[model samples]
Target: MHSDKAIITCAITGVLTDPGQHPVPVTPEELAREARRACDAGASVVHLHFRRQEPGKGHLPSWDPQLARDCVQALRAACPGLIINQSTGVVGPDCQGPIDCLRATRPEMAACNAGSLNYLKVRSDGAWAWPPTLFDNPPAKVKEFIDAMAETGTLPEFECFDLGIVRCVQMYRQTGMYQGLPEYNFVFGVASGMPADPDLLPILLRLKIPQAPWQATL
Candidate 1:
């Protein structure tokens, strides 16, 4: 079925970008203002990544439950009816922080990284931009996150960093790990993951679970 409507989701502040150098919002007030602007510009949803609120630490990510609560509350007040898709991307299996935040905020949606990726980047001069790290999201970890989301009544948007991960999300649906139609989020543009190319969309659509809603993040 065809329609004229599109659901736009705005990511206000991404993770790890220095607030000093970039215009990333670091405080509750700043997040509220940015979210309001996004809603004003026709975005019905906002993807959020909470950051450290302390002085000189705005570049760092924070999973503090209270901080997450404050940010979510601020955004809700600023943008009425805005769907909050909270980021739950962490580096390892120890994900109590994200779980706590999920319980604390009870957001409408949350990201469930479907698989692992070698989070890496290279500088122009054949040098490493940052040390190679693994964004580990093993099966057990993924289950843990989905369970948390189920408890909090938050929908999980499976973030697929690779084609295999996309299939994994499909398996998740078949096995009844996540109920209902899966929301696939195809992630591209990473040096170690899928490239940001529109040509890949056909293959992805063919591979994804039938009739499931999906989006691309580049």
Candidate 2:
């Protein structure tokens, strides 16, 4: 067995998800409150994504280091010993925002997108749900994130959207971009990526490096 137990992680709020429509928490206090509730319900880790705090702008993502710090502090105070998992999935190359957040928060774990993907979704009428864009995370960009995580002593939870990306993480370790056994986060339910299929677990597990910690994100 890989371990004696499973660590449950609850995502507080996702980027671009409108708080008005959903129950996504925006402010630091709100995040802390929700995180406390999640902890009480059995979540030991809280995945964090800072959102804009200005009124009516809570739906947008925020990379403000101060905001990230505030949120982390609040969560720590509300739920002592709870592990923090910061989200570092950003598009394009300039990853300074996530890097800054990693330094400021010094979270126990942070997401490291394993590969690029065509972030897309389609409506019932064949119309695009949102403008098609690429969640670009090239080799250079991935390295930058890995370095930041290392500097902060943060574990990189490799977010693998597909089978090939899962393998890329192994290459990352082999190529010396990152050291130690990589933690895997097999993401599903994305329209353009892997499906939420139970049967695929066996294949993914087979490909993962032995004794590596892993989890499924849906």
Error of 2 at 96 (Å): 0.5
Q: On a 0 to 1 TM-score scale, where does candidate 1 land against the true structure? A: 0.97
- Among all windows of 10 consecutive residues in model 1, the one with the lowest summed lDDT is 1-10
Q: Which 10-residue window in model 2 sums to the lowest lDDT?
A: 1-10
- What lDDT would each prediction earn against the true structure? 0.93, 0.93
TM-score of every prediction relative to native:
0.97, 0.97
Query: After superposition, which runs of candidate 2 have C-alpha atoms over 4 Å from their true positions?
Result: 1-3
Off by over 4 Å in 1: none
Expressed as tens digits, the lDDT of each residue in 17-113 for candidate 2 is 8989998899999999999999999999999999989889998878999999999999999999999999998887899998998999999999999
Question: Could you tell me which residue pairs clash in candidate 1?
Answer: none
